[model samples]
Target: MSTVQLYAWGPALGAPSIDPKCVIIEAYLRLLNIEYTVVQTNDPQASPTGELPLIKDGNVWVAGVDRILTHFSMRNQDANASLTPEQRAVYLAYNAMIQENLYDCMLYTWYADMTNFVKSIRPTYAKLLSFPGRYLVPVQLKNSAKARLAKYNVEITSDDTTLPQNEKEEMKELQRTGWHHMYKLARETYASLDAQLGSQKYMFGDSPTTLDCIVFGYLALHLYPDLPHGRLRHILTHEYPRLAEFCERFNAAYFSREHDVSTPAEDVPSLWKVLVNNPRGFFSNVKDDIVSYMGTDAPKEKSTAQIDFERKRIWSIAGGVTCLLAYIIWNGIISVEFDGEQGDFESWDEYDQEEVDEEL
Candidate 1:
């Protein structure tokens, strides 16, 4: 017996409902022939964190797509459904890219840009920023973010309630464009998926892997756009027919149940593609955002821990103090690059890599 249960959500009415997270979990479970149950994520107030897509397995509970997929992957590993070693590496890489790069972009759109977004989504929520302690929202809004960040990690008190009008305006501005960046991320991520799917039917191969499910759920929310005024007509379903086909196939085969209230399985295909509509041109454009999303906030060369290292390097280099550290910091870097077309260099001895660094 499979201990797995899926939590799902969708539109309140009108549109055919689909939750990508639910579909991804459903796909992997069925493909692996694992047993599981499904439920709606319960909530009296609709918070950004999750009202849907939180699953409970006995005492162990996890929310969001990544955590849910990880839980199920740990449990199921049949040969037909298990990821190949090579596929496993790629899956991890892709999933990481989605979480760090794509999700950062998504949240920046959802949280940072979504004042208007929040308002647009307000109907979905039972209440507004009644999210405990409202005053700090304005404080975080008006000043240079650095000043407000001082408040971060500290508990908010009732005294923080009032804010200057300007900051309130700023907060509203951030909310307006939240969806734009996500639209950018969806295009970029979808392109990556299309390229891979065009190469092979499944994300990893003919058989779907745990990675595919992770990629599928979040993308579905954006592509399907069951929400009014958010549907992505820009990502023409014609551009990548195969990916659309994959989504449709999953919807039809896995979710087409009569009793399901959220999204009818019959409409899964259109709903699936509609969520993450475009990718080819979109993914290629956000090079800076992607790199920034991956990197830490510390300076590229200097860090909080080694502030003195830069000062020491500058003094040594300028004042004719020929210290060993200066040379080590500026003199050299070691790198190896390979092109697949040349030949396979899987082993160390084959490539002759003698690695030495100038010691400080």
Candidate 2:
């Protein structure tokens, strides 16, 4: 009976759907009775691996939600072990593809409501949110965010959920007029999916599989029930009942863990949009990205050219898996040295030995 350390995340942005991998992880761990700790992950900026959720199993470090969940199933004892050998491999491959595809569509569209997002989902966020509006979620973001948040709160939550007449009408107009392009992209994708789910139980079947796990989380956290804040107001729980039901069922089954936000604040997950596809391949959040969010001009030079090398390397490794087999074969993950300078940990555990690693 060994245990592993799972560094998880529940973000404050109140992205109700949040992380699919985490949802998968939660269901697997509980079903398998795998003794593990459910904790928030570090801000990617401060983590050894820039993304989460990360799982530490002895000397091995696995990142990304899908990667970590497979790590759990592979090495840990599976009480029921429903996945066949072939099935497991296929699930891994498909999960990666779908997750990336969804994100590509999502990130591009998320910024459209970059400002209006505050006014849309105020009720769900009104609780468990920390950080004041003044310094919260960056600056240029504050004013719009506050107005939107306040408006959203007023709409969804009234003494009896009776949003004011003017308030309702105003929100409706904003949806049709303001930031509509972004809204269309973000909402239409789900509208199609929602349409497709007319009678099915899951995406492909009655029984849930890996794909179901991903879809459930993605839709719940991002789609379903509502649009991103204020931009896509046309789509709401009242707008799409079946899809909304799907989201509710998925969350009830998967994200059932107590997301008690206060303790060990570091465990919560926060996603930052980075300009990773830069020409020179320098990765940075760029001061401008947060300047509006933070209401301050970015430092004269806040580029992460130096610190971003590792991030670039990791991303390059991931991107090359498709066509650059040779690059992967020769430019492997191990170390190479011209002159012998002490470098490269023999294993992932040496740098950060987890107390949980001992149990596992």
**TM-score of each candidate structure, all chains considered together:** 0.47, 0.49
Go through the candidates in order and give each one's C-alpha lDDT. Answer: 0.43, 0.44
Best by TM-score: 2
Task: Report the Cα lDDT for candidate 2.
Answer: 0.44
Model 2, stretches more than 4 Å misplaced? 11-24, 27-33, 76-110, 114-184, 191-198, 223-240, 257-360
How many backbone clashes does every candidate have?
19, 20
- lDDT (Cα, 0-100) at 274 in candidate 2: 20
Model 1 TM-score (2 dp): 0.47
Model 1, global lDDT: 0.43
